[model samples]
Target: MGASNFVQEMKEVGERLLLKLQRLPQAEPVEIVAFSAIILFTATVLLLLLIACSCCCSSCCGPAARGRKSQVQPMAPR
Candidate 1:
């Protein structure tokens, strides 16, 4: 049921997008190429920033704990 609802929503969104596109004026070849390039460049920059942020802010790459002592001492030899 959830899947069907999701599909219906997607279909509606697709229909709306198609209608919007149809209402838009046709673009020249040069304009289309320029628009595509701009979109690609923006996407590339955003993706790169996302990757950089993840690497910088990730726990695995974060700074080490300062002045924290381990509570568990080493086990005595048997």
Candidate 2:
């Protein structure tokens, strides 16, 4: 009974939200394109951030920076 009541309330809220949204002005083609571009850019940025985090989190520092011995080359005077 409680669950049914909760579901009914959610349905009513959804219907009300839909009615409110229907009253809003329709999107112009330019606005639609702009929104699409914004969403695409946001998704791209999120994907890049996820990739960077995955790469960075794999090691304490990074694979290249892991205290490996390197040759100390004397800088040649140009």
Best by TM-score: 1
Taking the candidates one at a time, how many backbone clashes does each contain? 0, 0
Report the CA-based lDDT of candidate 1 relative to the real structure.
Answer: 0.77
Q: What tens digits encode model 2's per-residue C-alpha lDDT throughout 24-74?
A: 458677766776686699899999999989887866577767777688999
Write the residue-wise lDDT of candidate 1 on 1-78 in tens digits: 999999999999889857755754686777667767866998999999999888877745555533344688899999
- lDDT (CA) per prediction: 0.77, 0.79
lDDT of 2: 0.79
Residue 5, candidate 1: C-alpha displacement in angstroms: 40
Q: Per-residue lDDT for 20 in model 1?
A: 52
Report lDDT (Cα) of residue 39, candidate 2.
Answer: 67
Against the true structure, candidate 1 reaches a TM-score of 0.46
